[model samples]
Target: MVTPAVSGGDLARVAIVGASLGGMSTASGLRGHGFDGEIVMVEAEAELPPDRPPLSKQVLTGEWPLERARQPGSATLDELGVDLRFGRRAVRLDVATRTLTLDDHETVSADAVVLATGSAARRPPIPGIDRPGVHLLRTGADAAALRAGLAATPQRVLIVGAGFIGLEVAGSARELGLPVTVVEAFATPASRVLPPAIGMALAAAAVDAGVDLRTDTSVEALLGPGVEGAAGGDGDAPVAGALLSDGTTLAADLVLVAVGAVPASGWLSDTPGIDLDDGVLADATAMAAPGVAVVGDLARWWHRGAGGFVRVEHWDNAIEMGRYVGARLMARDDAEPYTPVPWMWSNQFGAKFQLAGHVSPDDALTWIDGTPEDRAWVGVTHDGTTVKSVMGYNRNPKVMRIRMRMDGPDGLALVDLLAAESTQ
Candidate 1:
């Protein structure tokens, strides 16, 4: 809880650009906190924003209907008296005026503004990426299109990148009994985030689940029908396969590019006084500029715990940061700085992996309970003293308990965590 620089009573209208989870949470929080300001939510999509986690799992596998993926609908926002402006894209923002310029040339002025535009899936410059058969999953439309592609029963599925999104899609494809091949540039899956040992453990799980996990590989180019060594051309033919860096060709009717995501901060490129180094740079309180705050994937805020700036794309971070910003706007006095232990979960190959706190490959990883080979295990990441993060597979109860203990300022020590586990 941080005291907002601007007084809540002085705010007559608060405009939230992008009706994403973070945006919606801020609106709900402002109203819940007894601020009687006008809330106008602008969304690019016509339909209400849907939950993204299911897009890679249940939604992609057709296990859950598309409707189940939807978050709070219009009725819920209406009850909160939120002026939902759908099908309008925000084009620019004038931080000085706290005004937003929509693509339709409509201007929205507010006393305070919240930017929760979120992020867009990255489609690497690999040729033929825009081909009809290729896909990127970041929005409801992307998920729907990928779902339709999966329904087509392609003979083989090729996925680029072995991050959480790519791996989740691979898991879903496996559930559908489809042959899947995954290519990752790292030596192991999720090496950028997790330690090599943990990545190898996850890689082993994927391999055991029948995924053609190809590590240390990159896609040189995507191939089209009858196009030898050349990427797709002007013709609208779908992608047929991909040529790997190893000079090998893989036949895959459907290609999913899940490399990563880029913050949707392009609209603010020309906006002065706002830092956009990979994302909108903000202070610990999540404030970017006067009367303007950013949340969700678009926010790369300073993390007091990490001693630096970090942009977390986890669903939990979005909700927590949104609520924090919302409450901060209504606060009258100073409160604690926003220092949250990040948390994220993933479902793949019927195993649930949960990670809490910020983890770095440089951190010392020590398995506390069981080894990675076990069905249930827990690992602690620390800088030889204080615990930095905790990761677990199929052990939710223990992982969540340890995660809670990490909330304090001086976080739980590694010795204490291990001692507590030993006593258990």
Candidate 2:
């Protein structure tokens, strides 16, 4: 990395690292919005980028072929005049001179730089986490390894953590005719996000699909890879079983960890004047540096509804925030501000879940629809009667109309609209 005191520029020579969703989207969006400045992208991967979301879902299940997931060609990049430095890893950033040094020692300079490198999967410190039959999904390799393990049609599977990833894995395992048991330290599936009632319903769905759901438990240690369980899955203590923190044991041949992810902002930690919180901090406009900006899961800006700084890690946030950051970059004024409602989706069973707006951490959650027992549900999150957020499970259209209503006055009058959708 080029280390210097400070550099000066009016507009900017922009460089984006990580050709992931946020980075590529920002490059494409900026050009679309008429940014004429010289732009370059640094991608760390060896081959052309492959789609990530499918790696854990359709790709692993053989529902979709791998080629379908590859990102579109650089024709878009070429049309936008983006110089893509592929196969180069960005090792460090020098905030003093505003330059990034690649693994090859080649330095790229930018007046403003956005750190959109997303997070990685966390690994357990246990002795056997690195052994075969254990899986962690974040990159394609991790998913591919887990996919190979699942291909054998093992009778038993063990999943750690019931967060989005873990549940998705359990759902996939069940789909493949495996008897899966999920172990979560939390009390319920997605306990962090959903209410107790909703979480139980979700857990029940997994159980209904033949999952041996174990909640409020954690793995104390992982045993040797050589010890396959009685069911022939990777075993602990001669039989594939996990030493649970509660003095209990659960057996399975395969183990998957899906606890959570930390922000991929460690490289920028030494970069001076860069505001670092849960992720790189951004102002209302998503600007963390003058002539520079941040977006996607890595950009932690103040969420109005949440009343605090939060990093919204969802596909929509990455896309919408990238577009806004690009537009702001192209405007050449660094003045216009844009904000979008945070939204995310998960397709586990035949159900789809969606949330619009930010839900307060401590906000009171009222059922717009009755409760999670119904396959379809909606919750109106309130901050003193002003509906800050409206979340739905299979009621997206109703949520859309409610958002329209909140922005208008019809929403307050048409509170009865939720009742009809609740029965679905």
Candidate 3:
């Protein structure tokens, strides 16, 4: 763990932008670590930060109320003495002066700033993407609207991307008895995150679960009856269907564009010393600039294990990064580099898929137990016999054990570890 030199000062007030999971967690962490200074958490949303993992599963399925997803609830924030500023947006950040400007034309001078603005859903460059009935899941309102839209029991749902969010929504939609059709530009689902073999296996599961999973496909345009075409001049006509690149049209009563996400770094444009390529580029300790730290989905920080700067957009990443940055900010000495074994899970078709460590396309994948067809398998991914990532479907403990072994002093080999486990 490499520790960077952080300056010493009064460290009076810490202003955290974007009061989501990362922001809330940082606030709690600071208070937990004996930071008596003022903690101001700014959020553009009117409501408190809510747990987002359940949005695609329970909330969307109506099994859990939206309020159940609220994190660091108002009571908790009050108990922590956090100056929670709801409906206030941070519009500008000047790292040199260590000042943050809000949308209401107010400026806050802080000893340090934590930019946890997170990321927003990325939509494709298709025509009529802004049309009604096209939805994105990023905020509480977005989830509410999507939930309400699904309550009517739409006939067909067209999910634009085969990512985790898309698959989770598909699972919810399937449980609701709505026909689902997924279109992806890649050959396999979730190829960007999981191994190609595992991605194809998940695609097979989708098919078995009655999902029309279409790969190597692209949505060129979104069509709807509107003022330009409909006779009644109803521009608010619901989304009719989508035009694909292969000259095919798929009818869709609702469309979820879950392509990906980009950092909400527009406000940090004028802020010097901050890299905004995929996200706010931070050092190994999650520091973007002096007295400025970024976390959550919008932080592209250096990872010692990956040997490069990586951006992770999972719930665990947000919590872990927020806590690490908070601890480092208040630590008396230079803190350790923030390196977490990246982990995430997706629940679809009543099956839970857990993955830990890093898995890249270049890594060699070997099945350790079970089979993808059974939806109950454990797999190990290796980079030239050095285990990189362990994946499991409904076998979290197995993957976790493998992840722990990888972190051991003697860098364990996948084959040797599996062989040893077999003997036990």
**Candidate 3 residues 315-396, lDDT tens each?**
9888888888888888734677777888888998999998888778657888888889778999888876778888898887
Error of 3 at 401 (Å): 1.8
Task: Please give, for residues 354-411, the per-residue lDDT of candidate 1 as tens digits.
Answer: 9999998767899988887886789999988999999999999989999999989789
Give per-residue CA lDDT, model 2, range 17-115, as digits (tens): 777778877877777776678777887776556666677678778787766676544446567777877789888877656688988999999866766
List TM-score per model, in order: 0.97, 0.87, 0.94
- lDDT, ranked from best to worst: 1, 3, 2
Error of 3 at 154 (Å): 1.2
**Measured by TM-score, how close is model 2 to the native structure?**
0.87
Q: What is candidate 3's CA lDDT for residue 163?
A: 91
Quote the lDDT for 351 in model 2. 64
Q: Candidate 1 has what TM-score?
A: 0.97
Model 1 alpha-carbon drift over 4 Å, by segment? 1-4, 72-75, 232-235
Residue 211 alpha-carbon offset, candidate 1, angstroms: 0.4
**Model 2 / residue 51 / CA error / Å:** 3.1
